[model samples]
Target: MKRNRNFSLLLFVVFLGILFITFSVISVEARKYRVKKSKPHKHQNDRNGNGNRNSPGPAPAPLPHYPTRSTIFDVMSFGAKGDGVSDDSKAIIAAWKAACKVSGATIEIPSNFQFFLKPITLQGPCMPNLVLQIDGTLLAPPNVGSWPKSSLFQWINFKWVQNFTIKGTGIVDGQGYSWWKYSSIYFLQKNSKHIPDMKPTALRFYSSYDVTVRDIKITNSPQCHLKFDSSRGIKVDNITISSPESSPNTDGIHLQNTQDVEIHNSNFGCGDDCVSIQTGCSNVHIHHINCGPGHGISIGGLGKDKTVACVSNIIVEDISIQNSLTGVRIKTWQGGIGSVKNVSFLNVQVSDVKIPIMIDQFYCDKKFCKNQTGAVGIRGVKYDRIIGTYSVQPIHLVCSNEIPCTDVDLIDIQLKPSPGYRGFHQALCWNTYGKSQAPLLPSSIDYCLGKNGDPVKRIEKSHEHVC
Candidate 1:
């Protein structure tokens, strides 16, 4: 009887244990259900107030400038150290993402801070007219090791964004010393494919529209300090771009497949062209710029690799170029088909420039180029009130042999040799048909012509293309 009673007691304890285990499992399942039901909605988040009720769709019309109260997303608030040594790219990107979702938003990089950044692309079809208010310095990494494999083409890129304004007095510093050194060695060896096919541009806006970049300073670019590719409605004002004169391919402002651009009141000192207008660019106006220690404003070396390029209606006026390579130039390659027309340079002043006025259809930067017959057509180019001091010749016009340049005009031109002892100054011309107005200096412009190599009579001037 005692053994049976002990067995019953053991059965009772096991039953109590099973009951407790069952209740614990049910409690765990209930908690899981509650947590799942409490999750936030997919489109709305409380952290940044993103996906709010009034946000516009993709590619909406530009909003009025700073409508209502601006929502500011300071990078410092998003975990940026801003000490120039820490990697602030992720924090800055977080700020941008939050700011891009709201209208009249600003991503502010405050003053007295230096944000060290690697290659970063701020891509958007985000809220229109967003402003990047930069008041601090943005410094790039010092070496190529910091660049990712995919982001070798550009250091800072704004892609597919519209109505964006980048304003304020900040410095964009690209530490390009290592890149310049490596590129120099590669050119000397001529066989190493180590560096990527194209060096990275400092800042590039690709396929963006209605962009305004103003009141900023950029320096030490690896290549092409500022570039606008396949973009429209650009306005650049009150900016300064500087790079070492020996830096390779560091153009101040490079435009390709872009149109409707106006650049004014800027300063540039670089290795390559101060402003390079490449293929498919039209309706451009560049004025009131100060350029030095670089190649002057140029159009083309275009239609490369037997391609067709069409550029028209460009006006460059009220410019000053000092201690530069070439002042105003139009260059195209051989074996290319296209036309560059209705271009005018007015009120330009150059000091100690190499060549003040140049038009070279056989523009070959390489050591040797195969001679080809087909060439791009150049017509209706006018130069007016271009007074300068030149180191080399005053003008050099070498047009295409197959299709000679036509309707070229030079008016009120005066160019003298720089203050030095020695070297004759003469104008060289070939296969270009043009007329020169009176008061042209040095009497060398008499060579400037018609199809029969005679001075073409000036007809009534047509209305110039209004900017």
Candidate 2:
């Protein structure tokens, strides 16, 4: 019995020893993570050389005070009604005028309030570092007839602004139903003598520099949702642009003559192209974009009306286009000059898309599209890692016969036609010279590639580009 008692004591001592060791290790680890000492002398050895490493510390020092910047100009204070019915254009103008003069000022449109505004221009070469912080909803006029001629092109235009940023968690509602009906009627009228100009885009930036627009929800634009014209160093990220699929000319984001633009992590579903990179654009990087129920992103529709369009150094990667008409296309009208070069589209995911890849030189929507000789030069184009399921044609490469595409390279391209469509998927090629280094659907890649002793183009319009 005594021996058993001693055994139990031994066991208990061992368990206690284990627990004590574990707690000691934990204490050591906890001591490793330490806060800075307020009194430096306390970290040193005590007079008797006891472990003073973790002495009873003094109270923590107070946090240093920072200078607060109270340069926020609230739109409500400018006599703007937050109601959805009142016209707040003048109030917005007044607030902008106040904020534009102060350096590093933020013009805030607070949350939960809908400000109804008319067409207005926010002209600025404002003091350094201005921010248009939008937290409330901004609604456009519902009737097109009520709009003036001055607002035909765009509803809200930011002109000549530098070092500007418009961002917030809010909505810019275009109320585009009326404009869509107007455009549809105008386009449908047979033998109509005068075709009025295109409808207004929602937000337009003209001749602006160093602009960043992000985290905003924009919807129902009458024409193009967002347009950046003659701007540089523009960044658009994490925005949602949406409209009905049947709406006409409602492009999500359009960039013309803009340079150094980065558009990433955005979702778009509009009538027209999700992102339209037009003529005179350069150094554009677009990635992580999700587009659907709309025309996929495109470069050109350029060279229209026999004009010169020069674009270069563009990259589009990691894009997904679902249920769209076209994906990753470059289109230019006939009878034009200049070139599109050094462009790359990589890591594209296409699902239920009509045309997965296209480069057209005869891009026209007019009923009587004039066929001409002059064409835009296309060179140094690359398509890589483009894997998709095409609903219609897998590929369409219709370059200009006069100025054939050159140095075009395709690699890692795997496409298959979607089920329920047994139309014998095709890849049509005309006047397009390119090297395909990857496998394609149906194993008939020679049709779209001027390789494997394929005939060089002279001039044959047997199959015009399928839009």
Candidate 3:
């Protein structure tokens, strides 16, 4: 009887175990089913935002659809004139206007031909979501004065527009060599009276959102290669800009009064700063860029008159500079009231550069650069992982009198120059107060001796002294 009772007990225990296992498996399967059932609904909600299953077919297709009419050749032929003297700007403008009216149309520039687009402004305070597609060369007028001012600035304002794109495999040649010549001549003559008509930019977008300019070759711009002024949400990718390094004021990209701007995967060889960020600009992220034979990225020469300027929260990373004048710089005038703060540089590589990093607060221009108070001040700057191989010292720091720089940090900065060049170093510092406590050199004695041949111990923590 005891054996029979033990057998019954064992069978009951096994049965209970089996029931628990089955229940656990069913619970897991049910949870998985719930998750699977919710996934599509979640995606649908993301797309529709209101959880409506029937939300207007794929957001009504972006404004410019492919395979549309070729507006440049088919619509505005203008007798295939390759020179800007043909007066095709009116026809081109008309074609652009017509194509823009029709949603999802491509204004194509046919290949194997050059279209000399005289200075013509393509102004658009128009509807959102437009695309300007180019496949042929849009040549600029060889004569600088012949290019109209209206076409350059007033054309294609694009203010308050969204989802605008400019994509092309073709070139927009500014023919800026002549313009540069004129500017030089005008400056040499000191002929302020002539006011040689201002040449329009190659591409200018203002107050626009979600804009993309990609895969285009822009060269020899009379003024700025690209200007983003008072605009937001811009992306410039895979674009190439080139000009003579001596080309006067030919900045690759100039941003002023803007926010949330990103420039990546681009190459710039220009006359001025590859990228210049001026007043009222913030949240700028620039990465994967190759800049050379020009000024690296810069913020200001700021605080002219009472015009307040502030640039903050900028990041420049993964950039390669070759033979540039300065790698990364923040320059402010000697007597202006404004502040530049919260700028960071990371993982930047440099070769053959004059100064890999610089902060010049004593920025004095010709004629009126008197030692003035409140020129501008820099604060909260962080430089990390900056490596370079060059002839000159890799770093320079200068601060102005009266208002000193504050909160500057240099972390993990490894700079080694080529043989027989000045070692990795720092230059003149006046009224500069900050901490560079992290020694980058391999030797502690060398670190104690500042690059300017002064003992680092005397100046390590002082605020008002010049080095």
Candidate 4:
């Protein structure tokens, strides 16, 4: 009887152990299911209050400005020949001058014709609610030899304007092929210092307020396609800018000393930075952009030449960059006192990019650079949902040793090497500090980035990437 009772006890113990093992397996599977569903999707906009956006449909171009047609001033009526060969600069200027006097007026360039213009300035203390509608094409004179020696480097200048809209399906062609002969990426790289300065950008707005630019096609600029300086409350939507990959210094859009600006639904491919944010800029938002075959988007070599600079509250989201040298970057000169804070790059996708994320505290573009000590303070930056394939190193965060980058956070980052290429052992970092959470691929990097993590101290330094 004793033997039978002992055998019964042993079987009961075995049954309980089996039951515990089964329950543990079920609990682990349930927890993993919950975590997978909780990760973030792309946000709707960087500016708006909407939630995450998921595979939105195509967006159509909006209509032109809603100015009253009663006070219309047509360029053709002011002796502007629409023959594509005549000098129409004087006539276009006359129309702008006349329309500037009337409220809600429109300077209309009608379709079915082309106008060739030399350099022109459309000065404005324009009446409120003015619109410049370009339904026809405007061609720029390609003769750089005859241009004035001293210049503002702008083909069309809209100065001191307020409460205006410039919209249409028309094209602005810079005819920049002649300018590109000696000004290409290859030539500039081969001959380090002797690059020729290109001509003017197609359009520039100086000290403007409450402006809207929509539905325009700008092509082949000598410098940047469009530029804005010291402007407030600007919006640019549904614009297309294109140039060859080799075109030198042909940035798509450049801004300096601008505030409260939004650029959305745009496409850009040029030699230089697709969108460059210079000094004294704040509250800028860029969304739904497509960039390709160019240098990619960048925040300035701020504080250059030992100048003070400031940029803050910038956001870039839902962007696609392919075949570009970089995905998102911030560069600052070595000898300057300034700060870049509250910058966020979210939901960016890239393919074949050389460097996906980079922060260079020492940025030098000249033929020679003299190292100095003063540095820009960089803080409060976040990288979220950056997924892509990179041609070279996936991440580079080189901050100044004196003023280390603080509060840099990374979440949901997944990057791999480009096809058929050998992946690097780890990300490169120097004098950088950051934190990372789960959902980061190459999970080993998590070991590198912790609270106040410095990669150089923990990992071996590499000389593979020199500046």
Candidate 5:
């Protein structure tokens, strides 16, 4: 019985020990829960309070301070009034000065503005890729009296610039009416040499490289609408040039001593040659042009004043000429010394043109030019796929007797006489040596035939010239 009582006491003590261990575990868990409830998450504390649990979140990474892809220098920001009457030349010059220092800079002339600019030459050896974005109209001073005597040669001139671009759908209006009137009266005089040369070209690039002028409309120029002289790597596209049909000497684009030129997809309605290729020009490609009411593309009047000239590698293709004086003509003065070689005219369509294809070596512009013996050599000229109607003649190839044209080729030419044309459809050829591939429509050039009236074979001539 005593043994059983001792066992019961030991069992009661074991039960009490088990109850105490369970209470201690529950108390420790409660303390842990209280501590967790008192503390807040780090992110939540950072949002609700100034400091983080340890320190404030690092200050937001400062935004990078650098120029955008292309920095712009707007003319308006340079104090341009933009009113038609105000002089904006100063503002434009300021913008260009700022842009010239930075590479890949664009000088922006904003839209809805008519800026009257004086005769100015923007000279540059600027940072690469300088751009002139002309979204507004740039007007030359209206009155001729406003121009200084020295500035009458060019209205807007770009000189010595490289990798430059002038673009945007804007109008460059040379208010040339006053100058034209003065010129008309001056030309009527018997001896006009005394009259100072007053007409100014609308736009000119001199000694600039890799220049591009596109998407611009130039109108009513006193002289040439656009000119590149002593420049290289020129590209002119998608531009419109216009003037009165009787406006004299307003060639659409005049190239002199410029090489590696490309002029395409442009429309021209002017008084003079739509494109005038002067001396020292080569590797030129002119295509997809619309020309009318003007003299068609011309290569010369080169070697004037008994000077030496050289031109080569010219290709004019896919052209449309309507109501033009002549189509695809190369003219050189009588006394010039040069070699014009490797010129091709392909796929040209004409409507009411005076002469569809011509090469006039004895081209005399004045009333009377004294006959001279020396001439510019014309060789390797090809006219292929020339089709349409001509008002005066189908073909007139009058080369120089001194240096006759050689290796000329005509293939697939179909030029019909225009309606109401009573003259005979004849092709005139003199001092030209060439062969016709297929039978020319309307009339065949008998000059390209042998004495027995058969197509003559071309004799390869030596083309080395001193010029």
Candidate 6:
């Protein structure tokens, strides 16, 4: 009996030890998870609350203060000669730097004059409240060789600036037609014989906040018209960007690795997308704009190789497209692993568009893209109240053959096919809405195709279904 009791006691001690070990392990993991989850929010909140860095138990850095100015002409005491061949970039930079040192001042460029500016960077590290008001035309240097080269971005950068406003009724001409011509020639030559080198973008903005670019006409960009990376609280309004439709890679506005951005009341006519958002962007709102003669708004060609990119919480509404290639599109590269979720498109009006609505997951360009592991697909995209009058197919949703699309809702979409087209043309719907026909107006559902040409599905028309 004594021996048995001793054995039982030993077993009990072992059980206790195992339980303690498991409990300790679980506790440590839980604490670690809590810390991990709370750290980002804590840091974000601290930055928002304190307006700067977040050091534990210490006072945060004071917010950078900039003086406010009523007019840009108050700080301009110098001017560059209007000779077309003279380099004005250095003079402009010097004047801007001096004005930035003075609080709340405007650096003005007067009217009735033309000046040639070389590729120059207008940086704002210690200055926040400087306004660059141009009432005159700022022309680009004639020679493309005068532009500098950098590996960080194709264009020169305006970095880490805050409260900066570039507003005026002036023109900033990139004089980019020559550059575009050269690039085309280079590409054509390379295609015939060898691989050619890539060129740089026109304008690149990095790590800037509270930036407002308004009321300007920008023309003839060499590469992308405007690009923003890792910027927050950026508002682009009342601007017009125009390049020749044949201009290659002249995207109007491209956003990558950014957050909290809004683009409104703008017009874009370019070769590539009117606005393309790629990789690591969130909380993006694009509204009240006109896009045409270009590729439409896009999401990705994301996650090539081991690189991972995600886009979330994007809204595109109140947009008008005229004679564009595709109006609203979401494209993802094959063999990429990322989720694009909570995207909403509402009140979009299309006229004379090719593919008005498209979600292409098998986006492989440049000599028949091949993926060994199959295509990666998109998740959780919703479209409501999209009306398209198309010369071609009204809506085209092509998912990957392997991983098809899921959670797609299209409501109150009215497509009026162009004359000489077949009656109620092919609306390619696959792996979407799960064997349910879209809610359409009563008069148009008799010949509609749903889920591999089955006819049991009927359109839904509730009074609340009117878009």
lDDT of candidates 1 onward, in order: 0.87, 0.86, 0.72, 0.83, 0.87, 0.71
lDDT score for residue 283 of model 2: 98
Model 1 over residues 1-467: C-alpha lDDT tens digits?
Answer: 99999999999999999999999999999999998766546665554554443453234458779656559989999999999999999998899899999987989999999999989999999898799998999999888766787987889999999989999889999888888998878778767767655678889999999999999999998888999999999999999999999998899999999999999999999999999999879999999999998999999987788788788999999999999999999999997887888999999999999899999989998899999986777878999999979987899999877777877898899999998815557678888887888788868886665543423212111111211
List residue ranges in candidate 1 displaced over 4 A: 1-70, 451-467
Report the Cα lDDT for candidate 2.
Answer: 0.86
Q: Which numbered prediction scores highest in TM-score against the true structure?
A: 5
TM-score of each: 0.81, 0.81, 0.74, 0.79, 0.83, 0.74
Q: So what's the TM-score on candidate 6?
A: 0.74
Residue 48 C-alpha lDDT in model 6: 42
Poorest stretch of ten by lDDT in candidate 3 = 458-467
What tens digits encode model 4's per-residue C-alpha lDDT throughout 1-467? 99999999999999999999999999999999998765544443423432334533335469888965569999999998999999999999999999999999999999998999888888888899999999999998776555555552888889999999999999989888777774654354765544446468889999999999999899998788999999999999999999989888889999999999999999999888889999889999999999987878899888888787788899999999999988899999997777788899999999989888889988888777988886777777888999989887788888876666767888888888898756574777676667887788656557555366455322212211111
Backbone clashes in model 4? 0
lDDT of 3 at 337: 68
Clashing pairs in 4: none
Instruction: Order candidates by lDDT, high to low.
Output: 1, 5, 2, 4, 3, 6
lDDT of 3 by residue, 1-467 (tens): 99999999999999999999999999999999988874554345544454456543335446785784442333345344544356556667776666666555556666666776655555664445567776677777777556454464522234555677888897887787887887778767765655465656777777777888898888888878888888888899999999999987788998989899899999999988999999889999999999988988888878776456678899999999888888998988766666787899988998878778788877665665566665455667877777876567666677765656666666666666666776555444455544554556423312322232133223322321211
Model 6 whole-model lDDT (C-alpha atoms): 0.71
| Model with the higher lDDT, candidate 4 or 6 | 4
Candidate 1 matches the true fold with a TM-score of 0.81
Cα lDDT tens digits, model 6, 1-467, are 99999999999999999999999999999999987765545345453464234544446679999986433442235557756566666678777777767666687877776768766677776455778877777786544566554431444457777888878888777777767777767756876432225555666788888888888877777777788888988889999988888888778988998999999999988887899988889999999999988888888776676356678899999999877888889887766665676788888988877778888776776777776443444555767777867777777777655556655666777777655655336676554433223555323332332343222111111111111
Report the C-alpha displacement of residue 155, candidate 5, in angstroms: 0.6
Candidate 5 residue-wise lDDT, 291-393, digit = tens = 9889999999888888887899999999999999999999999887878989999999999999988899888888899999878888789899999998898
